[model samples]
Target: MIDYIMQYQSEIWQAIGETFVMVAISIVAAILVGLPVGTVLFLCRKGQLYENRVVFGTLNIVVNVVRSFPFLLLVVFLIPFTRFVVGTALGTLAASIPLAVMAIAYYSRLVEQSLLEVPRGVIEAATSMGASTIQLITKFLYVEARSGLMLGMTTSTISFISYSTVMGIVGGGGIGDFAIRYGYQRFETELMVVTIIIMIILVQTIQYTGSLISRMLDKR
Candidate 1:
């Protein structure tokens, strides 16, 4: 184990950093874009306080289109745009564009769903108290659904990590890149075992931490 780490220490560390960068950038971007999109969807959705057929229909279609594309296909289709934006369609940042794109779509729908679950009565009560649109949203929508939103975001985060392994196929370096290049391709089952174990451990840690934080924040 030490020998493997020693031989590839620098590379492994580099991959770890790249993976972290990918996940962080993706999460932040997703939240920023998804929040408003989801909030709008919730407001405009049928029977909501601010219901609008046009806005809701457009958002629903766009989000559906995004989610319809399989991740690998999305990555391939994004190459042209990725190259245009990043000057190369391979590497950490480039790989993350698709991941972030996917995250926004995936998370926006989840957010909409979460906000929808915040009872109509609660929103109506807030408005009866003369809450402004913003006030109602901040107070009623977010406050009521905070725990569910956290869990959904946590699920998205863990999911992206697993999906990121596919990026390694396109030369986006990470433990996935390492595992695929050295372990799978070269038929090093032991190396593959090590890498898979590490990924499992990482996911479990994230899940536990997220659940704890969600519980801590849950007033209900």
Candidate 2:
């Protein structure tokens, strides 16, 4: 195993870098776009401050439609759009377009769910105190649900890592692609095991860090 790693260390490192690039882009989308989308879903629901059945229904349907597609199909289906946006349907950047879309849809649902977990009393209290919409969300809802949001982000990130693996089908190389090409395809079982172990360790570290911070932030 050691000899194998030393022999292909550069390639392995490059694959890991590609994976990071894809996952990083997805993470950014989840925060910048997904968070707001989910917050809107929460605020637009019936009886909420910004309640509007039309807005809620439209967003809900879009989220559902996106989520309903099998991820593999979603990647293939978005090829044209991805190509148009990135000028190519191959490489880490192009692959990231689909990953980002998936992240937005996936994390938005999680965000909505996390916000739903916020107590109704808290929202009511904020309203009674005359909090503006922005204030209610930032100072009340998000403050109360910070821990849940953290956990949700942790979950989304792990799913992103898993999803990035399949991007290799479009020439988006990552650790998984490295394993497939040099391990499975080449009968290098030890290399595959090493890559799997690397992924496991990376996931465990993220989960642990997220959980620790969530616990620290929890007031109750």
The reply for model 2, stretches above 4 Å from the true place, is none
Worst 10 residues of 2 by lDDT: 46-55
Model 1: residues >4 Å from true position, as ranges? none
Reference-based lDDT, each prediction: 0.86, 0.94
Over 123-143, each residue of candidate 2 has an lDDT whose tens digit, in order, gives: 999999999989999999999
Among these predictions, the greatest lDDT belongs to 2
TM-scores of the models, in the given order?
Answer: 0.95, 0.98
Per-residue error for 93 in candidate 2, Å, reads: 0.3
